[model samples]
Target: MHEWALVEGVIATAARFAEENGITEVTEVVVVVGELQQVEHEVLEFAFENLKTPLFKNARFVLESQPARFKCRNCGNEWGFTSEGMTEDVSEAIHFVPEMAHVYIKCSECGSPDFEVAEGRGVWLATIKGVKGDE
Candidate 1:
Protein backbone atom coordinates (compact mmCIF):
# COMPACT_ATOMS: atom_id res chain seq x y z
CA MET A 1 0.00 0.00 0.00
CA HIS A 2 1.01 3.63 -0.39
CA GLU A 3 1.14 3.84 3.37
CA TRP A 4 4.45 2.03 3.22
CA ALA A 5 5.86 4.77 1.05
CA LEU A 6 4.41 7.39 3.34
CA VAL A 7 5.99 5.86 6.43
CA GLU A 8 9.28 5.53 4.63
CA GLY A 9 9.25 9.17 3.79
CA VAL A 10 8.44 10.12 7.36
CA ILE A 11 11.26 8.01 8.77
CA ALA A 12 13.68 9.35 6.23
CA THR A 13 12.81 12.91 7.01
CA ALA A 14 12.95 12.39 10.75
CA ALA A 15 16.25 10.61 10.55
CA ARG A 16 17.72 13.38 8.49
CA PHE A 17 16.49 15.95 10.96
CA ALA A 18 17.82 14.02 13.94
CA GLU A 19 21.21 13.55 12.36
CA GLU A 20 21.48 17.19 11.41
CA ASN A 21 20.57 18.28 14.93
CA GLY A 22 22.62 15.63 16.71
CA ILE A 23 19.55 14.18 18.37
CA THR A 24 20.36 10.92 20.15
CA GLU A 25 17.23 9.95 22.00
CA VAL A 26 14.08 10.23 19.96
CA THR A 27 11.07 9.66 22.19
CA GLU A 28 8.23 10.45 19.86
CA VAL A 29 7.38 11.29 16.29
CA VAL A 30 4.01 12.90 15.87
CA VAL A 31 2.50 12.91 12.43
CA VAL A 32 -0.61 14.70 11.32
CA VAL A 33 -2.54 12.96 8.57
CA GLY A 34 -5.17 14.53 6.41
CA GLU A 35 -8.39 12.74 5.67
CA LEU A 36 -8.41 13.82 2.06
CA GLN A 37 -5.10 12.06 1.65
CA GLN A 38 -6.92 8.89 2.74
CA VAL A 39 -4.06 7.72 4.90
CA GLU A 40 -5.00 4.41 6.51
CA HIS A 41 -3.78 4.57 10.11
CA GLU A 42 -3.42 0.82 10.48
CA VAL A 43 -1.32 0.52 7.38
CA LEU A 44 0.84 3.46 8.32
CA GLU A 45 1.45 2.05 11.80
CA PHE A 46 2.22 -1.38 10.36
CA ALA A 47 4.76 0.12 8.03
CA PHE A 48 6.42 2.00 10.85
CA GLU A 49 6.45 -1.06 13.03
CA ASN A 50 8.11 -3.07 10.31
CA LEU A 51 10.58 -0.46 9.11
CA LYS A 52 11.84 1.44 12.15
CA THR A 53 15.52 0.99 12.93
CA PRO A 54 17.69 1.31 16.03
CA LEU A 55 17.83 5.08 15.88
CA PHE A 56 14.12 5.16 16.47
CA LYS A 57 13.72 1.95 18.44
CA ASN A 58 12.51 3.85 21.48
CA ALA A 59 10.46 6.40 19.59
CA ARG A 60 6.71 6.19 19.53
CA PHE A 61 4.94 6.88 16.27
CA VAL A 62 1.85 8.99 16.82
CA LEU A 63 -0.71 9.62 14.10
CA GLU A 64 -3.23 12.40 14.38
CA SER A 65 -5.99 12.11 11.82
CA GLN A 66 -7.79 15.23 10.69
CA PRO A 67 -10.93 15.88 8.68
CA ALA A 68 -10.95 17.14 5.10
CA ARG A 69 -12.22 20.66 4.59
CA PHE A 70 -12.87 22.68 1.46
CA LYS A 71 -13.77 26.22 0.65
CA CYS A 72 -15.91 27.30 -2.28
CA ARG A 73 -14.40 29.51 -4.91
CA ASN A 74 -17.70 31.12 -5.79
CA CYS A 75 -19.27 32.00 -2.46
CA GLY A 76 -16.39 31.62 -0.02
CA ASN A 77 -18.27 28.79 1.60
CA GLU A 78 -16.44 26.02 3.45
CA TRP A 79 -17.61 22.47 3.97
CA GLY A 80 -16.56 18.90 4.60
CA PHE A 81 -17.88 15.60 3.31
CA THR A 82 -17.75 11.98 4.43
CA SER A 83 -17.56 8.96 2.18
CA GLU A 84 -21.12 8.10 3.09
CA GLY A 85 -22.30 11.13 1.15
CA MET A 86 -20.91 9.79 -2.09
CA THR A 87 -22.54 7.34 -4.47
CA GLU A 88 -21.02 3.89 -4.65
CA ASP A 89 -19.29 4.68 -7.91
CA VAL A 90 -17.91 7.96 -6.63
CA SER A 91 -16.78 6.35 -3.42
CA GLU A 92 -14.99 3.64 -5.35
CA ALA A 93 -13.24 6.18 -7.51
CA ILE A 94 -12.06 8.17 -4.50
CA HIS A 95 -10.99 5.01 -2.70
CA PHE A 96 -8.69 3.99 -5.55
CA VAL A 97 -7.66 7.51 -6.56
CA PRO A 98 -8.11 10.21 -3.96
CA GLU A 99 -7.57 12.87 -6.57
CA MET A 100 -11.08 12.11 -7.76
CA ALA A 101 -12.44 13.73 -4.58
CA HIS A 102 -12.74 17.00 -6.45
CA VAL A 103 -15.20 15.37 -8.84
CA TYR A 104 -17.65 14.74 -6.02
CA ILE A 105 -16.98 17.46 -3.41
CA LYS A 106 -19.08 20.55 -3.81
CA CYS A 107 -19.73 23.68 -1.81
CA SER A 108 -22.71 23.17 0.42
CA GLU A 109 -23.87 26.78 0.38
CA CYS A 110 -23.18 27.78 -3.21
CA GLY A 111 -23.02 24.39 -4.92
CA SER A 112 -19.83 25.38 -6.66
CA PRO A 113 -17.47 22.85 -8.17
CA ASP A 114 -14.62 25.30 -7.90
CA PHE A 115 -13.05 25.30 -4.46
CA GLU A 116 -9.78 25.18 -2.57
CA VAL A 117 -8.70 22.93 0.25
CA ALA A 118 -8.48 24.81 3.52
CA GLU A 119 -7.07 21.96 5.57
CA GLY A 120 -6.48 18.20 5.77
CA ARG A 121 -4.85 17.82 2.38
CA GLY A 122 -1.67 15.91 3.07
CA VAL A 123 0.70 14.36 5.61
CA TRP A 124 2.70 16.67 7.84
CA LEU A 125 5.32 16.21 10.52
CA ALA A 126 3.95 17.97 13.54
CA THR A 127 6.35 17.28 16.39
CA ILE A 128 9.52 15.35 17.19
CA LYS A 129 10.43 14.94 20.81
CA GLY A 130 14.00 13.93 21.30
CA VAL A 131 17.23 14.52 23.20
CA LYS A 132 20.17 16.30 21.67
CA GLY A 133 22.91 14.75 23.70
CA ASP A 134 23.66 16.84 26.83
CA GLU A 135 21.43 19.62 28.12
Candidate 2:
Protein backbone atom coordinates (compact mmCIF):
# COMPACT_ATOMS: atom_id res chain seq x y z
CA MET A 1 0.00 0.00 0.00
CA HIS A 2 0.97 3.61 -0.45
CA GLU A 3 1.05 3.97 3.30
CA TRP A 4 4.16 1.86 3.34
CA ALA A 5 5.90 4.23 1.01
CA LEU A 6 4.65 7.20 2.96
CA VAL A 7 5.84 5.77 6.25
CA GLU A 8 9.19 4.85 4.76
CA GLY A 9 9.71 8.34 3.43
CA VAL A 10 8.72 9.87 6.72
CA ILE A 11 11.09 7.66 8.65
CA ALA A 12 13.97 8.15 6.27
CA THR A 13 13.59 11.91 6.22
CA ALA A 14 13.21 12.14 9.96
CA ALA A 15 16.06 9.77 10.60
CA ARG A 16 18.38 11.75 8.41
CA PHE A 17 17.40 14.96 10.08
CA ALA A 18 17.70 13.42 13.51
CA GLU A 19 21.22 12.13 12.86
CA GLU A 20 22.27 15.46 11.46
CA ASN A 21 20.98 17.18 14.55
CA GLY A 22 22.64 14.73 16.95
CA ILE A 23 19.41 13.10 17.99
CA THR A 24 20.10 9.64 19.33
CA GLU A 25 16.58 8.57 20.08
CA VAL A 26 13.61 9.43 17.93
CA THR A 27 10.68 9.48 20.30
CA GLU A 28 7.80 10.14 17.98
CA VAL A 29 6.84 10.74 14.38
CA VAL A 30 3.68 12.73 14.02
CA VAL A 31 1.86 12.54 10.73
CA VAL A 32 -0.95 14.87 9.75
CA VAL A 33 -3.32 12.93 7.50
CA GLY A 34 -6.32 14.18 5.63
CA GLU A 35 -9.39 12.01 5.37
CA LEU A 36 -9.38 12.01 1.58
CA GLN A 37 -6.12 10.09 1.65
CA GLN A 38 -8.01 7.16 3.27
CA VAL A 39 -4.83 6.04 5.05
CA GLU A 40 -5.45 3.16 7.40
CA HIS A 41 -4.07 3.96 10.84
CA GLU A 42 -3.45 0.36 11.81
CA VAL A 43 -1.67 -0.31 8.59
CA LEU A 44 0.49 2.74 9.14
CA GLU A 45 1.34 1.46 12.59
CA PHE A 46 2.19 -1.94 11.18
CA ALA A 47 4.44 -0.38 8.60
CA PHE A 48 6.14 1.68 11.25
CA GLU A 49 6.73 -1.39 13.38
CA ASN A 50 8.29 -3.21 10.49
CA LEU A 51 10.29 -0.33 9.03
CA LYS A 52 11.66 1.53 12.08
CA THR A 53 14.07 -0.92 13.63
CA PRO A 54 17.12 0.43 11.89
CA LEU A 55 17.30 4.02 13.11
CA PHE A 56 14.25 4.32 15.26
CA LYS A 57 13.80 1.21 17.29
CA ASN A 58 12.11 3.20 20.09
CA ALA A 59 10.11 5.53 17.91
CA ARG A 60 6.33 5.68 17.97
CA PHE A 61 4.09 6.79 15.13
CA VAL A 62 1.14 9.06 15.64
CA LEU A 63 -1.52 10.01 13.12
CA GLU A 64 -3.64 13.12 13.28
CA SER A 65 -6.65 12.67 11.01
CA GLN A 66 -8.29 15.77 9.63
CA PRO A 67 -11.85 16.04 8.36
CA ALA A 68 -12.75 16.44 4.71
CA ARG A 69 -13.94 19.82 3.50
CA PHE A 70 -15.39 20.99 0.22
CA LYS A 71 -16.22 24.25 -1.47
CA CYS A 72 -19.15 24.55 -3.85
CA ARG A 73 -18.04 25.66 -7.28
CA ASN A 74 -21.36 27.26 -8.04
CA CYS A 75 -22.24 29.02 -4.81
CA GLY A 76 -18.81 29.28 -3.12
CA ASN A 77 -20.17 27.53 -0.06
CA GLU A 78 -17.70 25.71 2.14
CA TRP A 79 -18.53 22.95 4.58
CA GLY A 80 -17.04 19.96 6.34
CA PHE A 81 -17.93 16.51 5.06
CA THR A 82 -19.07 14.90 8.28
CA SER A 83 -19.08 11.13 8.11
CA GLU A 84 -19.79 10.33 11.72
CA GLY A 85 -23.56 10.14 11.16
CA MET A 86 -23.42 8.40 7.81
CA THR A 87 -24.93 4.93 7.50
CA GLU A 88 -22.70 1.89 7.21
CA ASP A 89 -23.81 1.17 3.64
CA VAL A 90 -23.19 4.70 2.45
CA SER A 91 -19.88 4.82 4.26
CA GLU A 92 -18.76 1.61 2.64
CA ALA A 93 -19.87 2.83 -0.76
CA ILE A 94 -17.98 6.07 -0.40
CA HIS A 95 -15.03 4.25 1.09
CA PHE A 96 -14.92 2.11 -2.04
CA VAL A 97 -14.88 5.14 -4.31
CA PRO A 98 -14.05 8.38 -2.58
CA GLU A 99 -14.34 10.30 -5.81
CA MET A 100 -18.05 9.56 -5.62
CA ALA A 101 -18.07 12.23 -2.93
CA HIS A 102 -18.75 14.93 -5.48
CA VAL A 103 -21.53 12.78 -6.90
CA TYR A 104 -23.22 11.99 -3.62
CA ILE A 105 -22.35 15.02 -1.49
CA LYS A 106 -23.97 18.11 -2.89
CA CYS A 107 -23.45 21.72 -1.99
CA SER A 108 -25.54 22.76 0.95
CA GLU A 109 -25.98 26.25 -0.39
CA CYS A 110 -27.09 25.54 -3.94
CA GLY A 111 -27.40 21.74 -4.05
CA SER A 112 -24.69 21.42 -6.65
CA PRO A 113 -22.19 18.57 -7.02
CA ASP A 114 -19.65 20.77 -8.72
CA PHE A 115 -17.18 21.63 -6.01
CA GLU A 116 -13.55 21.65 -4.96
CA VAL A 117 -11.84 20.03 -2.06
CA ALA A 118 -10.95 22.83 0.33
CA GLU A 119 -8.98 20.42 2.53
CA GLY A 120 -8.31 16.75 3.20
CA ARG A 121 -6.11 15.50 0.38
CA GLY A 122 -2.61 14.52 1.47
CA VAL A 123 -0.37 13.48 4.31
CA TRP A 124 2.25 15.64 5.98
CA LEU A 125 5.00 15.08 8.48
CA ALA A 126 4.00 17.52 11.16
CA THR A 127 6.83 17.01 13.61
CA ILE A 128 9.61 14.70 14.68
CA LYS A 129 10.42 14.76 18.36
CA GLY A 130 13.64 13.26 19.59
CA VAL A 131 16.26 13.25 22.32
CA LYS A 132 19.94 13.98 22.06
CA GLY A 133 22.54 11.25 22.55
CA ASP A 134 23.72 12.86 25.76
CA GLU A 135 20.21 13.26 27.09
How well does candidate 2 match the true structure in TM-score terms?
Answer: 0.73
lDDT of 1: 0.82
lDDT tens digits by residue: candidate 1, 4-65 = 88889889999999999999878899999778767678888889999997888889999998
In candidate 1, which residue pairs get closer than 3 Å at backbone N, Cα or C atoms, i.e. clash? Answer: none
Error of 2 at 99 (Å): 8.3
* Runs in model 2 lying further than 4 Å from the true structure: 82-114
Count of clashes, each model: 0, 0
- Cα displacement (angstroms), candidate 1, residue 90, comes to 4.6
- Candidate with the greatest lDDT versus the true structure: 1
TM-score of each: 0.84, 0.73
Q: What is the Å distance of residue 132 in model 1 from its true position? A: 2.6
